[model samples]
Target: MITHIVLFKLKDGIDRDTKQVAEAVAYAREVGHQVPELVDWRVGWNTVDRDISYDFAAIGVLADLPALQRYQENDFHRLAIEKWRLISDWVVADLEDQ
Candidate 1:
């Protein structure tokens, strides 16, 4: 399987408060539920005391590289990512079966 992980730093002036942050987190949490290639998904908000250089995270599992690619190319993904782009500085990595 492939594990796709991502972290996001909110753009300046975007996430104005805890409510905004919660909404953004909710959006990310919906991705895997709506996308087929996503076998599993988890999303989180930063709560550690350390400097929050990043505000959000997404972890996803897919069956293989092709499945991961398909997830990346899907319209649902495009829309979701575009929404994230307005609020985030995105970072991502994908890991395959070990």
Candidate 2:
């Protein structure tokens, strides 16, 4: 299995409560349900206050690299990413389960 994780930090001057940001967060939380290749999906806004903490995070598991690629290529997933791109900078990591 492959675990795909992402951390998002809002861009300077963007309000976290704005419609775009809210929708982006919601989309991130729901994409797994829309994509057949994704399993065990989870996403949320960060509640902790730390200088280095990102504003949001998402994690999902896929069966393998091809599954992960399919998830990335999904239309809904791509739209969600575009929304995030408007308001934040993000980083991603993919790991294989032992």
Point to the candidate with the largest lDDT: 2
Residue range 1-98, candidate 1, lDDT tens digits: 99999989888787547565666666677887788999999887767646746777899999999899899898877877877776778889999988
Show how many residue pairs clash in every candidate, following the order shown: 0, 0
The RMSD of every model to the true structure, in order and in angstroms, is: 2.1, 0.9
lDDT of 2 by residue, 38-63 (tens): 87899888999799999899999999
The global C-alpha lDDT for each of the candidates, from Candidate 1 onward, is 0.81, 0.92
Error of 2 at 92 (Å): 0.4
* Candidate 2 Cα errors over 4 Å, as ranges: none
Model 1 bad stretches (over 4 Å): 16-23
